[model samples]
Target: MAQATPAKPFLLPAAIAATLVLCGLIAWMIESRAVILREGTEIVLQSEPIDPRDLLRGRYVVLGYPSQRIGGPLLDPLRAEIGEGETIDDATVYVTLRQGPDGYHEPVAVSLAEPDEGLFIRARATRVAHDMTWLFLDFGIGRFYTNEHRAPELERRMREGALTEIVVAVAPDGTAQIKALRQAGETIITEPLY
Candidate 1:
């Protein structure tokens, strides 16, 4: 009878390759956020608290920004891009922000093309109004995870009008990550770069 070749050798190499791939993927994710935290421009945004519950992901605070909706001058560029009888939805847009006297960054302009200068956050248009006069945008920085014990207290303070805000780091390309949470201009929790 012919000798059977062993499967152990192939199994060992496959398992090793799989583990290496996983490690590389995890490292890439961590480094991407770290780059933003380390070198990006910092901006503070006024936040509104929403629900704080997730059975699978644990407790986290959901944040809403007044700047989420854009209209008037801010929508002009986007409006000009839409052709007659054409609808725009789920398109990438860059929003230039100017800091108000209150130290909160507000949307100053929105463009289908990335701004050559100015601090802007990249967002995807969730939907364009029928009149093409407004765009609802998602910045993708709306969630802040916290420990179970702290989640409730933070939400309560926000609900009771404690003036909560989020400190975000925005990369040159407009990618952003939450760097810290603030209450009345005081830093509450700082995210680790890892």
Candidate 2:
């Protein structure tokens, strides 16, 4: 009987090592999804979707804050709210919100008459996910989210009695992100006025 040539010894061990690496990778990936990031609050801002060509992260969903919701521009709120001799200059006006119908914060912009007269919520300016310097609230992927516009309404909402909540999250680059003036303490029933 002819002796069979000995099979190469490297094949079996290589196969086993490859299998272990693949299995380890699969297990880690499955476990990682269970982790939650950003121990913080959620704020639902009126956002209109946008897609703009940028230097990076091409064609993404951008949310536009509802700047003009209830009041029309023709009815200058400044004229109605402020007295004579108040300069309509670019002032860092803080909005105070009052609970509107159905218990939503309706923002009323206040002219800070005296220095340090109002309560200001804390917020941070961050670089958007390894792209531009534009800052936004980092909600979990595929969940409720908002942009810089959220800040104004949130401040206004608080002015309308909607209290802002602090949110912190880790970005893709491991940077801690934060948002301020987000209505987090109260449970908001997101609904249309009509």
Q: Tell me, what's the RMSD of every candidate?
A: 1.7, 15.5
* Residue pairs of candidate 1 with colliding backbone atoms: none
Question: Which 10-residue window in model 2 sums to the lowest lDDT?
Answer: 125-134
Candidate 1 per-residue C-alpha lDDT over 1-194 given as tens digits, one digit per residue, 9 for 90 to 100: 99987667688889999999999999999999999999999999988889758888899988888888898877766667766767768888899999999999999988888999999999998988888877888999988888899998888887886847899999999998999988888988899999
Q: Mark the regions of model 2 whose C-alpha exceeds 4 Å error after superposition.
A: 1-43, 57-59, 68-90, 102-104, 113-194
**lDDT score, candidate 1, position 112:** 81
**lDDT at 20 for candidate 2?**
100
What Cα-based lDDT does every candidate model obtain? 0.88, 0.36
Name the top lDDT candidate: 1
Q: Write the per-residue lDDT of candidate 2 for residues 21-134, one digit (tens) a residue.
A: 999998876444323133322222333333333344333233334322223332255445544444433333333334445333334443333225322212222222222212
Q: State the TM-score for model 2.
A: 0.29
